[model samples]
Each structure stands twice: as C-alpha cells, then as structure tokens.
Target chain A: MVSALGIQLGVVGAYLLVALAVGLLAYRLTSRDAEDYYLAGRSIGTVVLLFTTFATLLSAFTFFGGPDLAYRAGPEWILVMGVMDGVLFALLWYVVGYKQWLVGKAHGYVTLGEMLGDRFGSKRLRALVAGISLFWLFPYVMLQQMGAGEAIVGLTNGIVPYWAGAAGITVFMIAYVVIAGLRGVAWTDTLQGLFMLGVVWLAVGWVATAAGGPSALSNALATNKPEFLALGGGLYSPQFIISTAITIAFGVAMFPQINQRFFVAKSGAVLKRSFALWPVLVVLLFVPAFILGTWAAGLGISVPEGANVLPVLLNEYTPVWFAALVVAGAMAAMMSSSDSMLLSGSSYFTRDLYRPFVDASLSDAREAWIARIGVALFATLTFVASLFRPGTLIEVGDTAFGGFAQMALPVIIALYWARTTRSGMFAGIVGGQLFYLAHVFVPAFEIAGITVLGGTYLTWDFALWGMVLSALLTLGVSSLTAAAPEENQSRFSEGLRAD
Target chain B: MTRTSIDYLWIVTFAILVTFAVPWFLWGDSRVFAGLPLWLWWHIGWMVLAAVVFHLFTRRAWDRGIVEGGR
Candidate 1:
C-alpha cells in the first residue's frame, strides 16, 4: 500500500497533464467574450456535445456507487437503477428536451434562469431562479470536490493525505477553468471520459478472471447473498425502491445545469441521440460494476456502513495498477460532474447576479472575467462546505434534488401555467423549499416523537410527497392571486410552444 | 374515438415495456434464463422487457431526428 502511493502520484499526474492539454487546446479557439466563456458561443457540434454530455452525466455516483450498491445489495439494485437511468434519459429525449432545445435556440437562452426570465417576462423571477439553482447545486459541486479528495486518498492509501489531494485537485481545476472555460471543460471531459470507460471495462475483465471466471463468481455470490440474487425481493424495501426510481427519474428534470446542457445541443435530433446512448452506458458500464459488487459480497467485505461494498472489495481483489485506474476513474467521474456544475452554478452568480444586477454596464470581456472569478469563489466555498460531509450520499442527493423540485414550480408556472404571478411563483418556491428542508432537518431537532411541524423528512420514499406539495403550493398560490400580466403570459406561451 | 390521452396511455404502456421493462426481464438470469427462482426471473424479465424496447425506441427516435441547424 505504501509503494502504491508512488503509482497514485504518477497516474493522477498523467491524467492531469492530459486534461490540461485538452484545456490548452480549447483556450486556443476562444476570444474575450462572455458568450464564448460561458456557452462555447452556443455552437458546440453534435459529437462533442454528445460525448461531453455522456461524460458529464456519469459522476462518482454512477461509476463507484453502482458497484458499491451491487456489491452490497445485489443484482436487483443494478437492474432497477440501470434501467431507470436509461429510462430517465429517454424521457428527457422524447418528452421535454427537444422542445427546450428549440426554445433555447430561438431565444439565446444560456441558463435556466434566462429561460425562465424570457418565459415569464420577469427579471426578478429569473434572479430568484438563478438564486435557487445556485443554492441547489452547491452541495452537488462540493460532493465532486469531496470525491476528488476521497479518490486520491483511496488511490494512494494515505500517502498523499486527503487534504493535500483535495487541495491539489482544486488548484488544478481552477487553472483549467481559468484557461479555457466551458470549451476546456468539455474537451478534457471527452478525453477523460473515454479513458475512464476503457479503465472500467478492463477492470471488470480482470476482476472476473481473478474470481475464477464469471460463472463461478456468480455461483459464489448467490450462495452468500442469495437475497441479491433474488432480483426482485430482498433487494430494497418497497418504499426505498419507489423512492429510488422516482427520485432519479423526475429529479433529473429539475437540474438547471443539465437544463443548460440542452442549449449546447445543435438540434432536437442530437437530443434524441444523446438519450439513446444513455441506456448503453448503463448496460455496458454500470452492469459490470454491479457484477463486481456481487463478487465482493461473496468475500464478506465491509465498507463504510452507509457506503456500498466496492471499496472494501476493490482493496481486497484488484491489482495495484487496476486500483490506480479505478481510483482515476472515480476521480474522473467527480471532476466531470463538478467542473460542469461549478461552471454553471457560477454562471448564475455572474450572469444573473453580477452582470445583470450588480454591474449592468460591464463589457463582454469584463463579464467573462467575472465568470472566471465566480468559478474560483464557488469552488472555494464548495470545498469548504464539503468538510461537513452531509449524512449519506443519498441524503445530500435528496436535498439537492428537492431544491430543484422547489424551483420546478416556477419553471412549470412560467412555461405552461399562465395564471401564475411572480408573487405566487416566488411564494410557492419559498413555501416548497422551506417545507422540504423542514422535513429533512426538523426531525433531528425534534423533541420526543413530535416533528417540528409534526412532519417527517419524507425520508427515503417521501421525496415524491415533497415534490407534490411544492407543485400544489405553486398552483394554489397562483390561482388565488391575480392573473399574470398579459405580456408575460404571451411570452411564456410563445416560449413554451403550447400549441 | 381518437383519444390522444388514451393513445398516449397505450404509447406509455409500450413505452414502459420498451423503456424499462423488457431488458430487465430478459437479462435477470444466467445465460438466457437458466437456473433461477420463478419470481426472480419474473422480476428480471420485467426489467429487461421494459429496458430493451426502451433502448430500441430511443435509438429509433435519435435516428429519426435532425440535430443540426442553419440549413
């Protein structure tokens, strides 16, 4: 393990060098403008867009957590989670994404806030949304940085130290962000993604071989964790299953950063193509992780109680070189998710907050610089916030996911529901977000059996209940208020294309 | 009676099959349905059946769309 530290520095250094080269290449193509800095001037081609989106979407959760869950739970979790991811993207393709892409193109909408602003004829609401988006996304961004640190430590096994690894990764990230902005992030993401994907396949093959081949491993796993083998039952309580499925499915719809990615798509067709690739990733990549998980279970390996089983299993089974690759892959996933998110979240801060509200007279070049500055600040805060790692990854997931659902009220109200007032939308958002947080945090502070408002955190399964309350609040508030101003309704309908 | 919602319902059901149901069913066992409990196979069957059709439909839709602009 001590010697493995040498490999860690070498591999991580190599990957960082490759990543920086991609950033430098991207920097060569841009000029000093906010548009270029933020959205690649809204002109990314289909292939780069597709690959980058693919790379961006598969974070540490999918890469590491999939195997972890599988190792702990069984085949059923993998089957459901994998299928749900594909299903989620497909729905994104068919139902909402294309239309959003079209509307975004028509209006030069770069951020979800911009989309809401245009749709609602209310800059204040846009700012509100921008605020919500930033708040919702911060923890997610922090998690990525946190993962980068964790992967470094895991990959090195305390040789590098978690703090040093985290700080080193963050410094590298800031340098990348300053050099190329979105272009650099997207380009490096593509190369990193391909590298990580290759590493996953090789690791799977190697592990399968070491375990006396796939058949024997499967047989062994079944004897040990027959519940996992059961597929349907013994996998998860029914409530957790529904929660898992719904949270992933609808929860995806609310992410503003993902929403922003839609605009970079060249057309609706690319949107569909992207969705098509989503399932294949699950089958090819995630399934193997789950299989690895199954293999780990047979060994009776222990992990962080809340963590899935792969870390312990990986430590036990895989070769050092492969471990480095797995570490690199996990780190890559974190970098991919965080870089894009940090960039987007900071866009809201700079674009909606500073550019429009703080300094309307700023030049395009100045705007670009401010955006770069925002990235630095956001990263620093996210890194700091991560020191207080929230409960389980799932709890953090719910908070972020629920935050977006709170904004879903404004999104739907602005686009489809015309009767919504800014006051109503704003009120609904506040009510929903507060209610969700209360449900999440209040129980811990509760005295005896009574919750603060006599409500629950909507724990694993009750996320849907939170979403429903948010939507209902938005709708009810809007109805009780006066109709939205006439022009806002027109712009919203036009933007929504509610023919 | 031409009902869009009803049409959508059928579409959704087919969607459920293609999107998340089929692949789950077909792939849940060892090498094309060997040696697994009856209920286990049923669960896998549902997942594969839903998932495979979903994959095909997704690809088909992607193949059908024109992703570029400024023609």
Candidate 2:
C-alpha cells in the first residue's frame, strides 16, 4: 500500500503546478510595463478585484490560524472574525477605498504612500508611511511563511522539515510574483480563492457528517464544552474581542496590499459591489470553519498541543485525497496572500523609498527592475525570519495588525482633514507608534494616579489606547499648526469630492 | 442625503452596534440557538443591519459629492 504521506504530497504537488501554470499564463498576457505589472493596468473588474483582496486578506491566518484559534479557544472567535470583520472591513472599504480609487485614478497613484505624501506635500511623510507600513507588514508576511512551514510538517507527519516547507513556498511565491505581477496575482488569486472556498466547504461537510452531523456536533459541544459555545469562552474576553475587531478593521484598511487594491478597481461601482458582497463571503467561509473546529472535540481527534489542528484534523478524519486537497488549499491561501504582499512591498520600496531618496529621475523600466529586486529581497528576509520561528502565527499577526491600526488615524485625517499639517500627521504616526511600543516593551509604571507604558484599560488591549492617543496627538497638533497652503487644500478637496 | 449626514449615521450606528449597542446587552446572556450562541446571532444580526445601512449609503450617497462634480 502506498504511504498516505505520498498521496498527500502528490495531490499538493499537482495543485501547486496548476498555480504555476496560471502564473505563466498571466506572464504571457501581461504587458512589460510598471502600470501593467503593478496595478494590472488599473483595469481589474468586480469579481477578480474582490476575490484577490479577499484571498490575500484571508491568508494562511484564515486557513490555519482561524481553525487553531477556534479549536483551542471556542466559537466566540468566529464572531470576532465572521460577524465583525464582515461588516467592519466592508464599511472601511467603502469609506476609504472609494476615495482612494478616485484620487489614484486621477493622479495615476499606485501606492498608499503616494496618496498620503502628495496630500500632505511632504516627501518625508511618504517615506515615514512606507517605513511604518514595512515594519508592520514584515511580520504578517512571516506569519504566512511560518503557517506554510507548520502545515507542511503536520501534513507530512514530519516527513519534511520546517525549513524545507518555508523555503519551498518562498521560492514558489517569488516565481509567481516575478512572473505575473498584479494581473497574475489577481487571476491566480481568483482561481485559488474559489478552489480554497470549495475545498474548505467540502472538508467541513465531510467532517461534520462523519462526526454525526451538525446537530450532533452542537449537542456534543453543549454537553461537554459549554464554554466553547458561549462568550468569554476559552481564550476570549469581552475586551479582547472588542479590541481585536477594532484593530483588525483599521489594520486591514492600512495594509499596503489591500490599500493598493483600491487603485486597481475598474470603477466605483465595481468597488461598491465588492465591498457589498464581502461580508457574505466572510460569513460563508468562517461559519463552517469555526463549526468544524468546534466539532473536532466531538470527533475526539487528537493533535499535538499547539500544533496546527486543521491539517491533523483532516489527515485523521478524511480520505487521503481530500486531506491533500485541503492542505493544498491552505498552501494556496499562503501563496495568494504572500504574492500580493511581496508585490506591494516592491511598490513601496521602488516608488516610495527608491524613487524619492535614491534616484528621482530613474526610468519607469528601471523602477520596475528595482521593484522586482525588492520583492526577492523582502521575501528572503521573511523566509529567514520564519526559520527562527519567532512566535505563534496569531501573536505575530496581532502585533502587525496593532501597528497598522495605530496608523489609521493619521491616514484618515490626512485624507479628509485639509487642516491636517504634515507635522501633525507625522507626529500622530510616530507618537502613536512610540506609545504603543512603550506599552508593549516598557514595564508598566503607575504613580500618583498615572499609568505609564501600560498595556490595557480595564480589560481592553493597548490598541484602543494607541488609537485614542494617536487621534488626540493628530487633532491637537493640527489645531496648533498652519494648515497646508490654500491651493493645496483646494486641490485636496477637488480630488476628494465625488465625481 | 447629505454626505456628513450619511457618514455620521454610519458612524453612530456602527458605534452603537459594535462597541456598546448590541454586544453589551448580549454578552451577559449565555443562551444557545441553532448551533450558535445568542450573542453570536446578535452580532450576525448587526452584520445584516450593517449590510442594509451600507447598501443605502452606497446607493444614495457614496459618490454624491465627487463622481459627477470632480472628475
């Protein structure tokens, strides 16, 4: 009899080959220019734009970490993402994305830093925005690599080492991004997104049925693990849920990869439709994944403590063929997310940092070359970090989310508040980051009714504090400073007003 | 609808629904329904309500000030 590992690897291998084929197809179709390469020539339609953003945002965290959290914590984690993320992310996409699209289209802007920098009339602000974005973005990219590595180790039953898994994805993702750019990323993301959604539902359906169906699974949890069904169950607290929801929504808004998608939309209607349908997609994916995770206890499937439960759950409970498909789907999630991130990182480096600081007069073709090189370097850095295995995927992901959340205030103010000076925006970004870092790194101190470098209020996390503090600094500084010149302010209004 | 009028409404509704409006009332209760907790259902209800609010905002006012005037 063939080893189960062999069958699983074969299935996953075949799936990845298809992904490569899709990338090569995109390469053939793509035009050799920055516009075509980075933003898909700014012509992405509703379905592709929606799925690419969805798949990239969902990532390995959604596939692997979501199940792990649900399995270990409880179903409340589901509501944290499913209900909250659906509404919050869609709302943000509507509010920020539409305006960004308008401005980006008018000016041919491609990166978030470009928008913020031009609005504030400060190149330093652009560099700062890119710097903060890269700082937060690296850990998220590393989380994908780490998740890929862990999934491989679990699926292969340690037939493969962790470094090999991490390196395999790193190399594959580099090839995918370098070949296809944004068009390829979007096309492949659409295909992989649908594949992941289909296989996930299939895995969940088979598992739930084999475990005696949904009602039986529910009954088992209700009887044995009541905490798993209720609020504040397992690892969830009220404050944690609230903080996480707020941070995730804002963090997503600022993600270079997600923000750049706003520029790729074909029209405002396409963007609107994408945001409108986003919550529905989240509901479909999250509801089943969380339910199956809860049902794992009912099935009495055992995984090593702190291991990724998704692969183990599949391998033990399903057919080898199905198990392989699910693993590949998870890998697809990682690749789809990583490619966009690698692509976005390249844009940040080339457009924001390289062009402004290194060579303002470089040809567009040379800029694209630098961008391609940037992608390889950024992916290499993350791959090396993943080998160290610094933290759990969720923890690292949350840190990145929190950093981006702190930037939301400055970004929003820069967009809408013409009075917002470059100094104020800069202060808001730096001050919030400084305070949040202090909160995270410095030991807590309290003296004379003052708490310094603290983490939480009542039970809420530091992100809330950081957001409030950042907003205050922005408002306070803006109130005291001279606004941008009248012409600049009018230009901003002209750009922001809906046409 | 005026821009701020709609924007502020979304802000208030989301604030009330997400931060204190719904979750506060549901958190204390521990009842389960249809394989999900009462609180979870409430959050889902908020999602539906939010979807409706978003649909209205996008239809009536999303591009009110920009699309026709600026471009």
Candidate 3:
C-alpha cells in the first residue's frame, strides 16, 4: 500500500507533468513572430480569452487569500472581492478594455507603454509606465511563489521545504514561459482554470456533505460564531468595503497581464461575450472557497499559526488524494498567474524599456531572445524575494493593488480625454505613486480621519485618496499644459468615431 | 460615437447596482434564509442581476459603441 505522503506527492507530480506537457505542446503551434509569441497572434476565441483572463487574474489571492480572509474576518470578503469586483471589473472590461482593443488593433500596439508613449510622442513616459508596472509587478509575482511554497509545505506536512516548493514553481514557470509564450500560457491557463474550478467545487461538495449539508453549517455558525453571519463586526465597515471594492476593481484593470489581454481577442464579439460571462465565472469560483472558509469557522477547525486555513481544513476533512488534487489546483492558480506576469513583463521590458533606451535598432529575433532572458532573470529575482517572505499574502496583494490603482486614472484619461498631455500623464503617474507610497510607508496617512461626534470616527482608505489625487493632477496638469498634437490625439479617437 | 439611450441606462443601472451591492441596509439584521444570511442572499441576487444586465447590454448595445464604431 502507498503511503499518504507518497500519494500526495504522486498527485502533485502528475499535475505538474501534465502542465509542462500542455505548455510544450503549445510551442509547436506558436510561430517565431514577436506578436504571435506575446499575444497569441491576436486570435484567441471567447472561451480561451475568458479562461485565460480568469486564470491570470485570480491567482493565489483568490485560491488562498480569499479563504483565509473569510475564515479570519467573515463573509463580508465576498462583498469586497466577489459581488462588487465581479460587476465592476466586467464594466471596466467593457469601458477600458473595449477601447484598448480598438486602439491596439488599429496601431498594432503590444504594450500599454507603447500605446501611451506613441499617443504623446514621449519615450520617457513609456519607460516610466513600464518601470512602475514592473515595480508593482514584483510583489505580485513573488506573491504566487510565496503561495506555492506555503501550499506545498501544508499539503506535504513539511516533507517539502518552503524554499524547495517556491524554487520548483519558479523554475517550472520560467521554462514554461520561455518555451510557450502567450499561446502556451493561454492553453495551459484554460486547462488549469478548468482544473481549479472542478477541484474547488468538488472539495466544497465533499466537505459540505460530510458536515451534514449547508443548513447544518449555517446552524453551526449561528451557534458558534454568530458575528460572521452579520455586518458591522468592526472588520467590514462601510468605508472598508467600498474602498476595497473600488481599489481592487481599478487595480485589476491596470495589471500588465490583464491589460495585455485586451489586445488578444480575435474579435469585438469575443470580447463582448467574455466580459459578459466574467461575473458569472467569478461567482462560480469565489462562492465555494468563501463558503467553505466560513463553514470551517463554525466547524471548529483549528489552523496552525502560519499555515493557510483552506489547505488545513481540506487535509482534516477530505480524503488524501482529493486534498492533493486541491493543492495542485492551488498550484495551478499560482503557476498560471506567474507565467502570464512573466510573459507580459517581458513585453514591457523589450518594447518599452530596452528598445527605446538601450537599443532602438534591435531585430525582432533578438528582441524575442532578450524578452525570454528578461523573463528568466525577473522570475529568478522574484523567487529570491519570495524566499524572504516579507508579508502575508493579503498584505502583499493589497499593496500591489494600491500601487496599480494609481495608474488607472492616467490610463483612462489618455485613452478617452483628447487633451491629455505628457506632462499631465507624468504628474499623474508620479504624483499618485508618491502619495500612495507615503500613505503605505507612513502609518498616519493610511487612514485619514476627521473628528466627528466628538471622536475621530470618519476615515477612508489610502487608495481612495490616491485615486482622487491622481485624477486631480491628471486633469489639472493637462489643463495647464499644451495638448498632444491633433493628429496624434486623433489616432486614439478616430476609430471610435468611424461609424 | 453617438450616445445611445442604452448606454445611459447601463450607466444608471450600474450605479444603482453598485450602491446596493454592499448590504448597508441589512446592517445589524441577522436574518437567515436558504442556509445563508439575508445580506449574503442580497449579494447573490445582486450578482445575478448584474450578470443579467451585462447579458442585456452585450446583446442590445455592445456593438453600437464598440464593434460598429471601431469598424
């Protein structure tokens, strides 16, 4: 008879091998062209586009952090992440993503920096955007590796060390990205996405049935942790809920991996269908994890100090093989997200950073080679950072979200408002980043408060203030500066006006 | 692109949906329904409604602002 540890290792190993095989298969279908490598030749169908976007955006945050928050804080996390974000991000997909697709199709643009810099005729702005994106992207990329490490340790009961788990994922991700590019990433993402969804739902069903059904869990919660079933529990305050919702929605819109996807759909119909289905998909995946987490609280599941609640609960309640499969699904989430980030980060480096500043006359083949090298180096750097384990997954994830949220106003203005100038863009991007950083680094400004009813009661999150400042600077600075040339401005607007 | 009534309606509908997505009205109420809290149920219903609204928008008005204009 096989030991439990051996079965777990076997399951996880099998999952990794299948992922590698899928990625290598994608390379055969991929061409040598830069566009084909980075954006899948801009021919992704609705299903592939939807699943890839879903897989890339969900990440370790959704699989691990969502359950952890629900277990600790309550079900209000659903409001912040699931219900609010689902609708808001879908709307942004229509408003921001649709415009980006149109503009990208017209100009053959591959990166956000390329689109913005060309519109304003400023290489510095391109480099600035790329630099900021890459800076925030590091923490998020490290987040996946960190999640992978913790997940493996929890699943294997520490038979696999954290560093080994993190390193294994990092190496596999780099190899997969270098070999397959976006085509492989998307195909694998679809498989991984399906795998994650299936395993999560299965785990939820198996656990809930064993616990005597959904009503029994609710009754157990009502008997034990009644505060979780209600609002105003000091954690999910109105301001906290609203601020988190807004920041995450806008932040997701600016993620380089997600933004690049706006340029990859085969047709407007594909984009329309994908966005329309996005919220439903979000609900499907989120409901299970959060519900299981809340149920765990009532069931008296005791988690170790540093281990994640979801994995711990799974191990205690589910069968060994199913637990391993769920952990593999979590690994799928991490690998899918990390591979996409590295791929998009490479594009930002090659097109925006290296070409304009380092070598303008590089050939496409050389550019592709440089991008692959950049992906490897960047992934290695983040893997090293992940080994440090600076912050919790949610803390690191929130900080990254706040950093990206600063870019949303400037990006929206550049795409829609014709009078947006390079000076304005620079001010908005730099100023918002500074203000956000100040708030993050300095505790006093993280929550600006006012004395109300003889107490310091009214407060707001830093992201709200950061976004407000960004909008003000973008509009104020643009009004005081000369607009981009009329012809250059027309490049963004003409296609929208064609009908 | 020409502004259509569907676009305006979508904006207004989303604004209302967002305002109510949070269960502020259900604050301090601990009523349970169908194995979940009433507030949680509200979010579930709201998400379903949001999806329906998106489906309607895509079928009725997505082409006007994006596909036709982009052409």
Candidate maximizing lDDT: 3
Q: How many clashes in each structure?
A: 26, 7, 0
TM-score of chain A of each: 0.89, 0.94, 0.93
Best TM-score among the predictions, by candidate number:
3
Instruction: Return whichever of 1 and 3 wins on TM-score.
Output: 3
- Tell me which residue pairs clash in candidate 3: none
Cα lDDT, all candidates: 0.62, 0.76, 0.81
Give lDDT for model 2.
0.76
After aligning candidate 1 to the native by TM-score, how far in Å is the CA of A277 from where it should be? 3.0
- Name the candidate, 2 or 3, with the larger DockQ value: 3
Ranking of models by TM-score:
3, 2, 1
Ranking by DockQ: 3, 2, 1
List clashing residue pairs in candidate 2: A497-B66, A498-B65, A498-B66, A498-B67, A499-B66, A499-B67, A499-B68
lDDT of 2 by residue, A1-499 (tens): 2588788878888888788887778656654533464644677788878888888755877777887778777767777785457877776786688878887887778888887888778788889989989988898998988888888887777777778878888888887777665446766777788887888899887887777776677788878777776667446776777788889889888998898888888778798788667766877777777666767765566766435778878887788888878888778667877888877877888889988999989897787777788878888999999888777877788888899999988877766676888778878999999978787668998888877666677677888889988998998898898866622554445644343
Sliding window of 10 residues with minimal summed lDDT for model 2 chain A:
A486-495
- Which structure is stronger by lDDT: 1 or 2? 2
Off by over 4 Å in 2: A30-40, A181-183, A443-454, A484-487, A495-499, B1-11, B14-24, B28-30, B41-46, B64-71
lDDT of 1 by residue, A12-88 (tens): 67766666766677657544433453553566655666666667556755665566556656656665565456555
For model 1, what is the C-alpha lDDT against the true structure? 0.62
Give interface RMSD for all predictions. 6.9, 3.0, 2.5
